[model samples]
Each structure stands twice: as C-alpha cells, then as structure tokens.
Target: MRARNKPWADDYLKEHDEVVVQAPFDNKNKWQDFFGNDQPIHVEIGTGKGQFIVGMAEQFPEVNFIGIEVAKSIIVSAVQKSLDSGQKNIRLINVNAEDLRDLFGENEIDKIYLNFSDPWPKSRHEKRRLTYHTFLEQYQHVLKHDGEIVFKTDNRGLFEYSLVSFSKFGMELDEVLLDLHAYEDPKNVMTEYEEKFSAKGQSIHRCRAHFPHRN
Candidate 1:
C-alpha cells in the first residue's frame, strides 16, 4: 500500500536537516567519518516510521544506525523519533534503497536489515523483492566480505523464496526462524508493521545470511 502524502513532510525534513541527512549520496565512502566513530554501521532498508531503527539505536549504542526510507511521509516520522531518542548514533536518509552502492562505498556497510519488506509475491515481480538475487548482488557491492543481511517478513511465500535465493547465491544462512516470535529473542527489535501484524497472530519469518567472500 502506498503511504498517504504528508503535505508538511518536505517542510519538516528541511527543518530537521541534521537528522534527515540532505545529501546522502555525497556521504558515500565517508559514513564512518560522518559518524566520527570506528563503531560498525548498521543499515535498515525500507525503514517504516522509524521504530526498529530508533529502538536499535538505544539498545545498541555501540553501533551506528542508518535508516533508508523512501516515503517522504514516513521518513519525517523517523526523523522525529531520532530527535526524541536523544541518541547520537542514528541518522536518517530520505531515499530509496534500490541501489545501495550509490550511497555506500565498497566494504563500507557492516550489516543490513530488511524489516518487513514488500513480499512482491507475483512471479513476474520477483526481481522487485528486496531479497531477490539482483538486490543481493547490489548488497554485495557495498557490504564487507563478511557482512550479513538480516531479513524478516510475514509473507510465507517470500520467506521461502528468499531462503532458496540466498542459498543459490552461495550465501551462508547463519540463522532461519520460521516463527520468529516463538523464540522471543531479546535482540529482535520490532518494527511498527511487525508489532501490528504479529498482534493479529501473523507469524514472522526471519533469517541471517552472508554473501560469499569476494576475497
């Protein structure tokens, strides 16, 4: 579903330029310097409303969190959340994650989170899925040789397909949970979508995968 247009989104973004990084592309290859820390950077693609990223920032202050949200309506809320958290380890980028390499340098990103991404169930639209082979390759371009992709979804079909896709790419499946909440892992940060849907008894599927070492 498309996000409802927020008329004031543009104004809000401009007002909070500090949190809503205005020129993310220019920061490519320089994210660590931007953070002014040697701590690892973790990225959340399709970050909706900022819940997961903000929560993670607070939980793991040792890590830097970058959220890439495409919807202007949604990113504004993320920016506000970061401000409220009073955490300096978080940054928001109002842009699509279609081509991560454009915003990150090779071997720059340490980890990526694909939280409740669109399932894109139709076979014809498989390539559009965030976990699609094409998308995985794009991730490889920017992630370190040992970097990991953490994917979560409520759609069973997409979960199954992604698991197979990861294997086909020779990516190691470090972890796979058919019913994530059943584990009740303390480290799992809930996205707004995950909270709403899981409340209705929708099981969340999750996995951690690593690309083949390019070295």
Candidate 2:
C-alpha cells in the first residue's frame, strides 16, 4: 500500500531536529561519535512506521539504532514515532538501501534487523528482494565480522527464499523459528506488521544469519 504523501513531511523532519539523518552523512566510520558513545550499532532496513527499531532502542539502551527507509512519506511517520517515544538512541535515514555501503564503513554495523520486508513476489523482480544475493553483498560490507542479520516475515515464500539465499552466501543460520510467537523469547520485539499478522493467527517466520568468521 502506498502511503499518502504528506506535503509537509520534509519540513516536519527538518524542524523536529531529532533522529532523521540528512544523508550523505559525514563521519562514516565514526558513527559512535554521532551517538556520542561507543555503543554497538544496529540497523533496521525498511523500518516501516518505526515500531520495531524504536522499541528495540528503548529495550536495549546500550545499542544505537538506525532505521532506513526509502519513502519520505512513510519515514516521516517513523520519525514522528521516534519523537513520540522520546528515544535518543535511534536515528532515521531517508535513502535507498543500495547506498548503505556509502553511509557506513566496513565493520561499522554490529547487527541488522529485517522485519516484514516486501516479498517482491515476482520472477522479474527477484533481484529487488532484500534477501537477494546483491543486497546481501551490500550488507556484508557494512556489517562487522561477527555481525548477524535477524529476519522475520509472515510470507513463507519469502522466508524460504531468504533461507536459501543466506545459505548460498555462506552465512550460517544460527536460529530458525517458523512460528516466532510460539517460541519462548521474551526479548523478541514485534513490528507493526508482525503484530497485525500474528493477531490474524498467522505464524511468524524468523531466523538469524551470520558469517562464520568471528574475526
């Protein structure tokens, strides 16, 4: 679903002067300086409406969170959510995921969260899927040696495809849960879509993928 364009989104983002990061941000490798601390950096790509990342920032104050979204209209809502929550450990980026490597340096990001991402369920658009090999390669550049990507989705097709893609990229699947809500993870936070789908009795699929080398 396309978000209605809020003509004032850009103005609102600028005026709030909070988590919205104006790219291309300077001090790529010095992200800790931006947060004014040496905390580990975790990022959420396609952070729709910001529930998951914002909640994570609140849950884990020790980690800095960056929420990246391409749509200004949608991201504006995310920024507003962040403001409403009054969380200082998080930031937002209005940019394409393809440019993440430029925004962050190698080994700069400690972990990544992919929640309820677009399945892009078309044969011709396979490359556009976030779990595609092309996108995975970009993620690897910014992630630390032991960095992990935790993914969740309600779509089985996308989940299966992501599992294959991660394995093909030589990433180790440390955890896999076909029914995330059934699992006993008190720390598991839910995204907007995750809550919606789960309420409808849909089983959430989840997994954690990481490179083998810890160094």
Please tell me which predicted candidate would have the highest TM-score against the true structure: 1
lDDT of 2 by residue, 79-102 (tens): 988999988999998877576788
The TM-score of candidate 1 is: 0.97
Instruction: Estimate TM-scores for all models.
Output: 0.97, 0.96
TM-score of 2: 0.96
**Error at 47, model 1, angstroms:** 0.6
lDDT of 1 by residue, 16-120 (tens): 877888899999999999999999999999888999999999999999999998899988888989999999999999887678989999999999999988888
State residue 90's C-alpha deviation in candidate 1, in Å: 0.7
Which residue window of length 10 is worst by lDDT in model 1? 93-102
- How big is the positional error of residue 150 in model 2, measured in Å on the Cα after superposition? 0.4
lDDT of 2 at 211: 79
How far off is residue 197 in model 1, in Å? 1.3
Clashes per prediction? 0, 0
For candidate 1, give the lDDT of residue 24.
96
What is the Cα-based lDDT of residue 214 in candidate 1? 77
